[model samples]
Target: MTSEGTFCLVLHSHLPWLPHHGSWPVGEEWLYQAWAHSYLPVVELLRRFAGEGRRDVLTLGVTPVLAAQLDDPYSLRTFHEWLGHWQLRALHASTLWRGQPVLRELGAAEHRAALHATEDLETQWRHGFSPILRSLVDAATIELIGGPLTHPFQPLLDERIRAFALRSGLDDTGLRIGHRPAGIWAPECGYAPGMEDGYAAAGVERFLVDGPSLRGDTSAARTVGSSDVVCFGRDLEVTYRVWSPKAGYPGHANYRDFHTWAHEVGMKPSRVTGHQVAPPDKAPYEPALAADTLRLHVKDFVDTVVTRLRRLRARNGKEALVVAAYDTELFGHWWHEGPAWLDGILRALPEAGVRVTTLRGALEAGHLGPPVDLPASSWGSGKDWRVWDGEQVADMVEDNAALQRRLLAVRPGPLRDPVLDLAVNEAMLALSSDWAFMVTKDSAADYARRRARVHTERFGAVLRGERPLPLEDRVFGQLDARLL
Candidate 1:
């Protein structure tokens, strides 16, 4: 328990603007998976921590695109229906497995989880964006940082797009959360040499970058172009300690396989046929066995945290911060047992006496290391921005870039006050991650095309000044003239 040991479990929550039609590959389903694993469960975990009166700050990032969905009446209604459906499915699961002792117990747990998930969704929506989470930010239990208006790829984007989106994001977030965010998620954690100037204009004090950006420099923050905006790297070693791309604990052999698929039988549901990754063994998600698996991973993670932090106490003698940031979608969506794993990790981190802090909280205390410049980088694969505008998605990126430039020329300059709202809309429309992800995954080509067309067209409309309504110009126009 050294004074220097501290950690920030920073979870970045975002989905590339999946509105009414974004339900298939890159839309509503994405929300359901994230809602199931990351948001609801994370909320419960933080709620428990708050109830325990824990003083630690756990950072939760809610991107503006995701915020719009949460605030949308249609999305909320859809989510309610999704919740109700899952509840019934859980009941079906319980009844189907009633004869098997172990499976029955697991089904019962799912049923309870289903019920809790619904409550958590409503609770979060009831406040516009998880009042508990918002409260945590205000109380500093969780540092609430936001991303761009629609979570765009910044470096490759036109600077105008970067300015409009980030500024609008700050404004919307302040409106929703009731306070200004101290840190920006930087949309995919993307950063470039002079991008900080845009952040600086938006009154952003700090942001998240990646390791290569730091280039082993270990500098916590550095200024750009006379702007005091500081950027922090993802602290890779500590982050990989929990969820590495290929070697993290979640991928262990004994963990409930995430690749398994199931089919509901006619009179009797068939057992999980098998796992695709681990092929030949498909036992589905057995909570009884999975609990042991979760415990193992949690202990290993906490042990690593303790060992690393202890070494930090010896090396730096300053408040040592291990910034372990991750995609929130990883918790429940990608990893089947992720929610349980997160619950285990959160509970374990505090009990082991490790200090948990957020990006904002960590900055408040200051860094001892000298400020070294970070390279242009992101939290994407290889700490590069390839996923956003790689060769596969280059055409899409170029199209958006050209559109962005035209929009700026026709509508507003970055410094102009009149063009602020239009800039906001086009900025958001350009940032939707659909096309890039579609190009990357290769399975959602049509879905991506549809989304890009939708937003790109929306941008064109704004540029032409054909749209007069605010919410509609931004979010397909809501009833009663409200901006969801």
Candidate 2:
């Protein structure tokens, strides 16, 4: 390698519990879309790279909730059904776009893409995602990282529940992947003053945070709160070049526009022409052009990493680390060209003198620095907790706090109560960071509000010695508190 400096790409993959929920544009559909698009393609690409002997391509953090759903029998069966429906939708689009030449071309491309995805899912992902992910981890092509159960914003959670959630999440990952993870994503990169104690107890060695959380000194990994667990900060200057909400590589003209949809067929038919262009006025998506654009982005990112690492090395007078972190859903799901871009960058970086490693790999490579008294922080809006505990969702914050207290106060008698376990899980689900994020974004505000309320209600009911309402027809009976 031309430089000893390392570049770690941390992909945080997470989604709240969504099975048995609504579909289309949200809920289980969200999981299925990400699965078929992001998860399947990204995994396949990683496997392909691994076959060619690539190692430490990236660190992948798959939250426990998402893992549970992906590994669940129902999710596997239902996802296949969803993929079949998606292929049919493309066929319908082909028919619907019969006359217009451009539309017909777009329909053909989408149809072929859907067919390819379905084939991949049937052949590789037929069983569950764990096997596929486990294979990658085994090959050392990627490091698998775990997160809290349900992906809660950990800063606001009670210490005991927080500790339990983190430990339980790692345990769940161990059960699925055949070994416990030594690191966690820390649920939204949210960190509190004393979180390192829990993380230390949970056996986490390192985690990623936003650059601002490190006070803009993200050139090296730093330990937090006297714990040996190192915290790496995301190089926003590198990550945002591909995926910022306002402008990023995804908004480039050649790529598919995520918003404009062929409603009848449930396909995106337009390219991102210009910011002001209405959906109807947007030009048809051309995969060939998008492929070329993907290459350009891949080269740009590789160059950017090379430049950043060189500068950091010079400034620090030693080998430095630059961590670029992002949501794994960005690939294939959010950005149609994301997986290709990832493939290109990984392939291009090594050839360009930038060594790619996981966060753990960086630490192992001796990128560690001194321990710092880290503040209560998160990677959320304003580099603080506003997106979750701000004025807009104050009620939710209170509700979560109250539920945590109630949950911790519950006595399970002498035996492990399955009902208590179920209720506690529900309460934790309600505290997921996704709901507050959704509410703050106003995209799925109502659903987020309802979900939070439902979980709290379930916890309350269970605590009051009453049975929570069943999903379908089954009824839960009251639990006896005096059984001890």
Candidate 3:
């Protein structure tokens, strides 16, 4: 049977640099959790697909900042230690909760998972993510995407700073993965009218934006502002099936609940029994039940894509493109059954007469639409810059503007100036979009504010020579101030 339009799944993986910072609740803990649950499993799954001779399964974006940490010696050692601790905690849970049958079962399940993850990390991820990612890229199993350093909100960034960050970020990816990707996730799918000029200059041929950014006509990738740079807008209708603030597949009663905590052992032991169910009243998480629910959701998602493509083809008179993008962390980290669901969907799509490919593959197959004069937008609230620039974050916006101005004033030359380069790095770190997004969402708002302010203060201290450059903040080691 002939296939419908192509389905491109783009997973944006990112975390602000966290080493030498706090650990618990919001720092390295955040990175390790995503690493253990999402990165480890997702990459392993891709390797399995590659072993099966799959090519161009999906597009994976790894921000330069996170890439650095994944490959950093400090991060590697710490992550291994973290995994060991995870195993110990799971064992402790199993011992402490043995009196309660339900909690004991959950504890035993967690221990098994933690043990498997530890072995996976010690074997496949021993060196770092670079080797594993490079092998997959070389095998043509996935198209890797790179994004700006620190994952700054580009639409709000100074043009010079934005251009420098994008180029440096691409270069960083090339250094780590041995391939500089032509596609980017565009830091929150944030875009401004002329950002494509910078993208084109940096050799970025394609990028992503929110569905509403392209006015919800995401049936095809559109070239922005006459540049050859293509903007692939997310098909919200398709993506929201798996993830959305209000509700999604993860909320299924059979799936493990992300919020319910087993405080003593630091594990989630409950299923999402009911939305309004108290945490203590939530049912114990049953892996087999979640697996059954995952199968159903996967089938539903495949059907959704089939129906969407048929509708789009009828309307557009062609096999249009349907792009569904999400944060890679959403998989095993936030949604415990996500990786399994992903595996099922990827395998099921082709069987259902749907062509699954990367964004680059879709474009090469002639999925391009007419050029669009894209307005300033982001994938944030309102599909505008409000989340980063609203009255609620006016102070942050102003502070970022001031930092950029100070950075530009330094105007360091092509020759590397240790002080100046470190200053630029600090400035970029402060400009990360995660901080404002967290503040607006009230998720670790205090930590986010502190991180931003600390980086900003360090930027000033470096410029004044009041603070010596620390080895800990050496994320962008090759960052040249001249790039700005």
Candidate 4:
């Protein structure tokens, strides 16, 4: 597998801050899913790679909200408890899976895998956060990216609301890791015409967009229309090869169905009948066929990435970069075997003579040929803002407009500290997608509302002149307790 130039893999990891306001089968659960699936597993894979003495240079955008949760003593504690819960569930599942003869041996294997994963979590937590990710960014193994404080859909929100979110995020990340970031994920990959000025203000020199955002400007990095900040878009072909709406390699029939979940609570033993059933209604846990299927899926996905990258290599005589970007949740969270696929592919790329690199590493190598005026665009649906703020999300727009109006009135001044804090806090909550998602069930609406309410209340208390917001520690403490 030959790569044209410096190939970069960027995984944007962000979910609206969902700590309290537990609303259900979806709410705080999303956080748990990320912890159980994506965060912990990916950390394991990367750490394992690091321990092997191979420097796996990859770029992953972890938003400030997520990073805060990660570094927070509260969040880490909750993460530990979640891991323990997963262990118990796995044990529960094993009991059910062993009942089936054809899957008994497979169930045993899955049980062993689960146990191994649980044991690995402790070591990963010990490996520490600043080193694995922060150190990588410091040493330039990874290009770190931040987003609005709570991850707001820019362009839709007022300039100050958006500005505050951006500032808080950049500021917080710096506080956490002791380094300033140069790029942001732009929540939902959302962007506006003049957002770059704020990026410039926040010390962010770059932001990501879709292929169309670059609009025929095939260069390493292109400047936004009349703006100094650089913008880069995802190459749909390379990205979709691994993740797409209908045809991504992850949907292979052989692999486990992410939505199938647990019917009767089994450790292993899937009940998929080819690809005819909806994910929610699928059968019990099945690992026998799932493992073989995952193996093949990983092989095919690696081949697809290799083939397309090689073709790009030959087509573009000059060294060109083939970047594969995706949501971090897709791995471990959406596709159960995704981390395995990633681990396999990351290893395979170098073997095929493709130099593994991160966004920062690649950009540092050289500029994109020349600069073209990039369009005002995003990586959303059809490379637009429909995914986050489309025809379907109008109500959420109205809700935020009022919230922003209220916040703009408060203006962090000399009056009351609690009043100002509440306004700022709620303003931050207003930018989150939880409420909007709750309004639209296309995703986890219930969980969305719960999360939205969480930040809103936190902001309200401070605004009510509670100055210090006594409940802050209580709320955060519960999160800490859950971890233990």
lDDT of each: 0.67, 0.82, 0.91, 0.65
Candidate 2, superposed: residue stretches over 4 Å from native:
463-484
- Compare candidates 1 and 2 on TM-score and give the better one: 2
Candidate 4 regions off by >4 Å? 1-3, 105-114, 126-132, 138-140, 216-219, 226-228, 266-273, 278-299, 306-316, 414-419, 437-441, 446-462, 466-484
Q: Output the number of the TM-score-best candidate.
A: 3
- Who is ahead in TM-score, 3 or 4? 3
lDDT (Cα, tens digit) per residue for candidate 2, span 1-484? 4665798988889888888767755788999999988998888898998899888889999998888788777788888888888878888888888997778887887778878888887788777888888999999989999988789898888887787778777877888888689988878789888788888888988887888888878888998876787888888887788876567899899999999998888899999988889998999888888888888888888888888888888888998888888899999899888998888888788788777888778888888888877777788778888999898888888888888877777777776676666676677778889999999889789988987887788777865779754542111122222221
Off by over 4 Å in 3: none
User: Distance (Å) between predicted and true CA of 418, model 3?
Assistant: 1.4
Candidate 4 per-residue lDDT, tens place, 1-484, comes to 5443556778888766555545246546677677677887887776666666655368778887676556556566666676666666666665765666655555555557656656765665654365467656555546678777767778777776666667766777777677767777777667776777778877888778777776633336676656677777677777787787667766766666665655454332454445777665555545556677766766665666667656665676556666678889999888777888888778776776666777666667664545556545666556666656666677567766766776666545444454454456555765775466455546766556545555556555666665464443231121111100
Worst 10 residues of 1 by lDDT: 475-484
Model 1 misplacement above 4 A: 97-101, 122-124, 217-227, 265-280, 313-319, 350-353, 412-427, 461-473, 476-484
Model 3 per-residue lDDT tens digits across residues 1-484: 8987799999999999898789988899999999999999999899999999999999999999998899889998998899888889989998998898877887888888888988998899888999999999999999999988889999898888888888899999999888999899998788888999989999999999999988899999888897988899999999999898678999999999999898888999999999999998998888889888888999999999999999999998999889999999999999998998899999999999888999889988889889999988998888888888888789999999999998889977667798998998999999999999999989999999999999999999999999977999978888888777
Candidate number with greatest lDDT: 3
How well does model 2 score by local distance difference test?
0.82
How well does each candidate superpose onto the true structure, as a TM-score?
0.86, 0.95, 0.98, 0.86
Q: Per-residue CA lDDT of candidate 1, range 448-483, in tens?
A: 776777667765665567755455335522111112
